[model samples]
Target: MQVTTATEAALLTSREIITGEELGSVPLATPGAVAAAARRAAAAAPAWAARPAAERAAILSRAAELLLERDQEAMDLLVREGGSITGKAFYEVHAGAAELRHAAALATGPDSPHGPGSEPGRETEVSRVPLGVVGVIVPWNFPLLLGMRSVAPALALGNTVLLKPDPHTPLSGGRLFAEVLADAGLPEGVLEVVHGDADAGAALVQAPDVAMVSFTGSTEVGREIGATAGRLLKRVVLELGGQNAFVVLPDADIEQAASAGSWGSFLHQGQICMAARRHLVHQDVVEAYTETLARRAAALRIGDPYRTDAQIGPVIEHGALTRIAAAVEEAVAQGARLVTGGRMQGPFFPPTVLADVTPKMAVFHKEVFGPVAAITAFADDDEAIALANTSDYGLTAAVYTSDADRGRALAPRLRCGVVHVGDQTVNHDPALPFGGIGASGNASGFGGRAALDAFTRWHTLTTSSPARAYPF
Candidate 1:
């Protein structure tokens, strides 16, 4: 990996999520070093941007190939460092590679078009220009794919990037990218990994040389970064938290709805931003849905992610596990029923289902990033929509119904960035623009053609054959 290995004042130790065995430690970059990295990226941006678009595209394409070539290693890193199950880890490898390939296409995509000027003998054209230096701060949930969402596109668009990954998953989130890119022949200093916590992240956002910052994490942290970037007049993209709803209409198939809801609530142990935190089901069928969901929750096998039989794995850390347990306890105290799986075995939290959950319960309104599905009953469509839209978060939502047209109609009414009909909330595509609104984010999305807009600014140029004489 090409990460900064310089020994410094503080150190971040990486441990296996399941075993808690100390794997390694890396020196943490101070705020001053982070600023210096930004300056270095700024200095390197020009030469990188000056390269032909095809050459830039070629590098990204090769980076994708290299990542796929090392898929097993990358997947293992994700499973060990990021607590992703083997299947999810494999998904990360391919999804991350897809993001790189998508960025490669962006590199050689058509330029902005020219237009006729208002006056004769005049020509006008608009072009997209890089932001110079970009700061990308990603969280640990799906580190590789999330990091690639910002890093690959920023690099492909001719800007140098300074990546700051969450300390907990540094290897999968940051260093792995550096290794793959370097192997793919990326120029030195075009991309650098600054490993630290809030200190390093804040430094990168406030660094004068960084023209833009793309952050994915908690809403609280995203708000702080937004304020800092605003004061500094830097461009910012924030993809924050979500308390997304998995709505089951009365007409929905109970079996299908329960299965989809179970996967949505418990996949990756429900640590995803788009994980279905709330199950808003119609009162007519709430009982059957809850029972089936609880059965699936109880059936999931929780163990080491490396184990082929383990469907659920350990959470990121003890603190997160504690918070998750506390949330469930508080919900039960507030009159929520624990249908099944409320306990933890070591670091593994088995899939949990909370029935009779009311809005008054903390788990009903707040996001508990664990394998807990809080179920609430709604009397009708209006009530279901109201309950679904109750949260301040608006990242993603899912609607389940036999009638496709009815699901489509209700999709728009739900307040979220992406709504899936007859599917789970945790879904991603590098070719689709993804983001959220309200406390979730500021709606500066990522992926596809939207990536071009996120990483570049428009520049207009005008030309005339001859200058007109002034009145004076």
Candidate 2:
């Protein structure tokens, strides 16, 4: 790709999320650069694909080690650039390494060829092969983990990749991966990192050489990418938004359920797609749960993530804070009682809890991707299940109850991708397939064997022992 003149290039400025202090900047890649990246990746795909699977696996394994070796650096970047608390940032680094290791395992375990049918004098077998070049677009939240989820799998499966990180977090999301892979001795052109706005993402998706696009972001943007990729006949995997639920049963321990609810709704200031936005508590214990949750919310310390005692940090910027505050205000105006907190102090939106929130309120029905927990009272198990399934999103859901058998039976009827019987909704594991149904995603789960399936294509070969006449 031709480098643009200094004056012609755009710059993305990096800043500390809590302090608004400018850290540094990087020049944004234009759409043309994105196209060039795809072309280069296509050129590099053949040699990478021809290497033995063991070699590929080794490189990814080394990459995983190198990633953790530099965990301090990555954790700091995540906290400063991504507005992540210390604990959440630490989780992202380790989770990203786990994803790389899982991808390495997938590299050595290509699906075995299977027979299709028993036909006279004919043998048929099906094998999985890599798609040439994959376009990966990741969002700002959990940048390192989400980026690795796509980039690592695609590279390990023998496909070259062009990654586009969100404009707000180019350094941690894009450049960090490049640095780690290079340190691990990965080939230069096999993984290209591009930074820009939506135009760059579009260019990567529309590039002729890119066979597939994997995107993780909002539902609104996922729809647009899906539409465009469909028109181009390109493969796509989208993991989008959610209004997930945390259900508290009458028989559950109120204190334990309250603790889970607090973490589910306030971790990372509740920016996660799987964060519990809706709290559905049985009427019998709703009052106690609300009181406990409200007290917990009021107690959480909000400040710079660098502080050892800080539990909550700032939202991305002023705009996000404004949006969160507006949603809380609107909900309160609609008769939802502000139980404890509904205020924004500078860039920090404190952990908030709202009670008597009904489906009529926007905060109850929509995705309030902030530290606001909207609680609604349900009368019975049937009502709790109904409220949990009310949203268009079918991501992860949590059910708290003393009876394990009841939780297991209700799990299948939740209509979501994952369920935690006694835990919170904000959970992730590299070995588990994760995604959602309905508006949450296109049901394109990532991780585990799903990652393998997402990056490969199946081909069938037929052979005959003796010469056979063709029916023409």
Candidate 3:
């Protein structure tokens, strides 16, 4: 692939998530510059990876402190990036700080010992060691937190990182995070930030010196990255697209499920990968649930994301609105009823609810990263499970049922990465594992211990005394 070198630097511009006005631009390392930085990181990787675990942890700890000290500045940048509403800036910053702190703890934590089944006098240990250089690509949605999830753990384990944040929105998140690491006494080139479009991301993914790649974005781009990494025989962890389902069983409280479902479908203008888009309701209560969901969705406040009272803001960009509109229109054209919303006022697409959706409609099968809820009424538990699992994408699914035994029995039957019995599908925790299955990407989870594992390789070591008799 040809790299762009037309300008000395690349400019990344984003639109305000509330006003639809341009938020100006931030300068980023161009593809050529990114390659140079990757080379620098490659040269520095071995030395960085050889540092003592506790010492490595200290840098992360300092980074976390610096993040807190500069909280306002960090949150300001995120708002300017416009990927998240102003109301959400606090959560992103807090989550990011927690990730850095957790990584520091992981670095200084005890090493893993061999399991109890080992033979006597044969000392064994399983240790996770850093990959030389990690190339990370973060999506516009939740850039600071998701991007740092890979960066913090990888660095704690002593791997150098070259991050390529989404061109639409980069700085004040991934770029800013790297800068803070520098302020915290991290050596230069250990964490580099390169910002651009797909070309820049591809350059990082294909870099021969990079030992592994961690990507969080759509499944289409993930497939390309995964394939490239496979060819190179390099380690890769991907968090891709999600078409999560919010299933309300017969025993569910319609009012409660309706409120949660509305929020789950419209949060962040429904840009989240795990945003609950599919609503599978039992036929017995579908009418009542739809009315409640529509009412709650209609009550949402929409305006500038920076406003404290704003519950729903503009979609990330005008193009996002167009895509969402097209999907909803197509579904409607195919006979799906637009129960609540299907109109866009500039970049603002109001909370939408589509009822009587069928498996054949685009709104049901395709992942719509917008505030459009596609509700399909099902006949029984078997049909609900079938409808929920029908989508090619299976990242998360939630079942709302009062009966514990039934919910437990049905949760696992859904072919998804995670299922919540009482909660909505749009839940995320920094300490738990997160990722998708099937087209949503590989089984590699994106947070907690699994995140650390994704960025590192495990080495099993065994030693025997002279008296030991065992095959090598």
Best candidate per lDDT, number?
Answer: 1
Task: Give per-model TM-scores.
Answer: 0.96, 0.97, 0.92
Q: If candidate 1 were superposed on the true structure by all CA atoms, what would the RMSD be?
A: 2.2
Off by over 4 Å in 2: 1-8, 110-113
By TM-score: ranked, best first: 2, 1, 3
Worst lDDT window (10 residues) for model 1? Answer: 1-10
Decide which is better by TM-score, 2 or 3. 2
Model 3 score (lDDT): 0.83
What are the lDDT scores of the predictions, listed in order?
0.90, 0.89, 0.83
Q: How many residue pairs clash in each candidate?
A: 0, 0, 0
lDDT (Cα, tens digit) per residue for candidate 2, span 1-472: 1123467676777777766667566778888888998999999999999988888889999999999999999998898898888889999999999999999999997585575767877788888889999999999989999999999989999999999998778778988999999889889899998888888888988999999999999999999999999999999998998898898989999989999999999999999999999999999999999999999899999888875568998888788888899999999999999998788898889998999999888887788889999999999889888989888999899999899899888888898898999888998887888889999887755888888789999888899878688789
Q: lDDT by residue for model 3 over 1-472, one digit each (tens)?
A: 0123336554666555554456555566656777888999998898898988888889988998898888887776676565456667778888888988888887877665547425887777777788889998888878888888889988988899998878766666566876789988898889988877888888898888888899889999999999999999989888899889999998898998998898789888899998899999999999999999999999988876565557787677778899999999999999999998899987689999999999988888899989999999999999999898898887988999888789999998999888888889877676788878887878755677777668777887788766566597
Top-down lDDT ranking? 1, 2, 3
